[model samples]
Target: MKTAAAAGEAEFYLEPMIVTAARYDNSAGKPGYYKVDEKKLENGNYDNALDVIKQLPGVTLMARGASGGMNAYSKILLNGSDRYLVIIDGVRSNWNGSSYNDFDFSVLPAGMLESVEVLSSAAGSVYGNAAKGGVIRITTKKAVEGVKTSINLETGSYGREQENILHLGKSGEWSWSVYARKSIMGDYSSARQSIPSYENVENAGIKLTKAWGETADLTLSYSVFSGRYKSKIFNYKNTEPDETKPPKLFKNIFMTDARKTEDNLTLEYERKFSDTENNIVGIYRRSSNAAYDRSLNVERPWLLDLRTEGFFDRYSKQWHPKHTLTGGVEYYKDQVLDYQDLAAKYSDGTVISKAVHLQDSWQLADSVKAVGSLRQDWNSYAGSKLSPALSLEY
Candidate 1:
């Protein structure tokens, strides 16, 4: 990864070192990618983000507890319908929740990431109606010109340990980026965040990108979270924790809590439309949230989330020979308010998950290539689906 005129000059390569092309970490390098970093979830015994996708490849990360209260909601099945899609830069983590916010991935901010891409499927004809079980794009960290900083500290074992983190970048041209993260983990009746159970969180994020002339560019982002957990029906002497299965390894006695807050906003664009290829993005996101479960003390089972998403694309990186083409169009809007705090409360409902997409890819030589896609989902009353797919790469 060189720029700024080949940065530091560390030549030790034969091939494969180039790094950026706007793809970021592509997680496990395609074929169901999995890139998770943060010292691999702070070492020993993970308990969130499905323990880092349960270690990649055809992923699976079922949980009942490990930190964070609440369970069941992460069913990312691709070939069998479950529709999984999450976007940090575009903010679209809605695919019908309950999977505990599907891939909490520790509510993001993995020390201010710079890459995290997981596709799970050739994208089933491209981003349409929640990506039909695949798409996790996260590219954080921008604003660079000078003054860069980062610091992190960690400790292990139950009643685990952690220290604050800070990353800052600045250089003018109206550039700025800031991040702060706090973590507290523990709850191992013998293994993994043991608590009256375990979990403690405080997170913050901010980003700004500028450069108004040249070709065109603008960006702004924000993230905030506050969480406290230990409650899962106060552990109820370790009983039900089913999504598929899991609940035995040394149980946690009892305790309760759940606090939440999530925010997101982004706007971006790039242009170059007349070279060999270029006409990148036009992204947008606005997410809202509020959740509370003070050990069932009150607040009437709170959970409120409002959403918005959109992305327009036209990317082609190859002129001839082996090819590259990413066709895209995606949109989503959701409004949900769930309050079941009992003792008399508020209940609201809203569901409108929409989708429209197209895909293309043809290369026949090089490594071998062929891909196709078409997706449509519009709901005035549940009726729309036309998925076509084929994949090969070797």
Candidate 2:
């Protein structure tokens, strides 16, 4: 870097970067955006994360996999306020009266993640209206100075299962880190047309962070998951099991169970004048859920959703010589209540919610980007949307 800018030292660039706008940084990639590298899993394991996002380039997937199945029902937005602006590390993964309730990459153990920031389209000035079909940002793993660890295992076939992760870290100035993960996905499957299959999945997570002095940082994270997808799934034989046609058989029976839990807490502050750095952050998130239709467990209908969310973000930065600027502004509030019960319903499924938020992302040139988002919503489909987004790079 021109001999470290002539010894004043300031040459930063590294890590498998790949971030299409959304105000870059995204760690690992010092400056030149587009960061990818931590474990290479766009969908190597498959079964979700949109199977590596349908395969990028225009991004589209149909009848491929990951529950977007019955045609398509996956929603991700930013810049507007689709599930409080769908986020990952900053928390909030979509849900506030259903955006199809994204985030079920089977349980996102994707090599414990470290990078993956995809803002597919309609950047809503930066990330709004669920980004239309964008925003899949995830950046995990940080807390370095010393000590690092990793472990993963995989098996195959219908009764297939396996997964394990453990991470430890220590950097300095009293820094600390800890993360844990576990998974078991069995009932790999044993029928396609004759029927009889089961799928069981589980996922877990834990994160802790600490740092004092010079600025300040504290973090706590917890995640939990449960899964149940009974099988007997297959499509074919539009007709023909017949001797007389009246026996033209067709059967569709399968049950499913799901549960999800998430918790997050963050507090950060940074004050530096000379190096030109600014940051103030506070975040709190919580989500609890349950679902079941059992395909028709005697009558179909059982779902409960409870959510609590709060997000406050602020970041500022400036670097000279040539020019480097970072900007941030965010505020989010979420409240939701969902209830459903039916064996033969008449009028009893309802959802009540409330929300308030704002978003901003700017980086004018390093690669070019801009984003703006504002949101206000209340209860069962009230109304409000103003999303803006733009990005340019060559």
Candidate 3:
């Protein structure tokens, strides 16, 4: 009786679709080098480059406070040495500019990074003695095919707040990326502080690139960071009013009023002669200035100024199916303009350095490789030296 109603039944089927992402790892070409995974960096939500560096194997970070805090003084020690090097987008960031100051990792925000590469073992041949302890290479974000924008905001205790914005776009052969960030701590109090401190930081940067087909490209990048902080200040009174009381100097503890500004500018050009050959030329400059007033209600001011300029030319060629050769020449000059200290004698000085290096990588077998490098360096103060290294991987 109901057979007419059961005649209309239908079935549908769907197939699965899979998507994959591609990532590049340049560490294979450099002995003793390792790259932090892109997926891990994206998911870690780290605040600054210092946090990521702290998690690497055979790395130790010694600091006074939090890694990126205003009151923090950090020293990156690798394999028990503090002579490591830091590079950002193919530009050297540290070891050439400041005399008494270390590279403050707090200035480098994590949201603007694309990748981080680390060399834990000695890399003296490729990067000179500055990399004796290790090397940290950082690459900033690049523009994609289309327009994109992102924003991040964070809040925490001690009246901490941070905001970051990044925008990227590409049109035809021109692409650019711009970013800005701000971090503030209105009231930071430590166990050793009787009063709260305040800090403010501002950072902004832009990178522009022009590509001529796939064989050549030119890039210009500039970034600046400004930070101001006032440390905990309180008064200590002599309740017993005696000349023998040693002048109650407790107020001088953690009392600081300082501001610092740092900027970096880099220009780079790359051309590919063929699929197996290429070359790069880069010029970079970096500077830092700081002003401090240690005494409250006093106008005494001290200034510290440092500057560095560098130029480099590098070439790469694949001579055979399994052999690759690379060579480079580098020049750098550093100057200290207005640095002064009572305990340490620091005066105006300029240092010039020149270096030449060559490296070869050979494929010994389907799954084995060998690399060798030699470098000669000339310094204005430290004299000249030759460094050689060899490594094998299977």
Candidate achieving the largest TM-score: 3
- Name the weakest run of 10 consecutive residues (lDDT summed) in model 3: 64-73
Tens-place lDDT per residue, model 2, 194-226, is 334344545566666665655555666666655
Against the unseen true structure, what C-alpha lDDT does each candidate score? 0.56, 0.48, 0.74
> Estimated TM-score per prediction?
0.29, 0.30, 0.79
Off by over 4 Å in 3: 1-31, 64-73, 97-101, 189-195, 231-254, 294-302, 318-323, 343-347, 362-370, 391-394
User: lDDT tens digits, residues 299-373, model 1?
Assistant: 345455555555556455555644556555555555555544334445455555555565666667544556666
The better candidate by TM-score, 1 or 3, is 3
Evaluate model 2: give its lDDT: 0.48
Please count the clashing residue pairs in each candidate, in the order shown: 16, 32, 0
RMSD values, in order shown: 21.4, 21.2, 6.2
Query: Which residue runs does candidate 2 get wrong by more than 4 Å?
Result: 1-145, 152-160, 174-182, 185-210, 213-217, 220-226, 231-283, 309-336, 343-394
TM-score of 3: 0.79
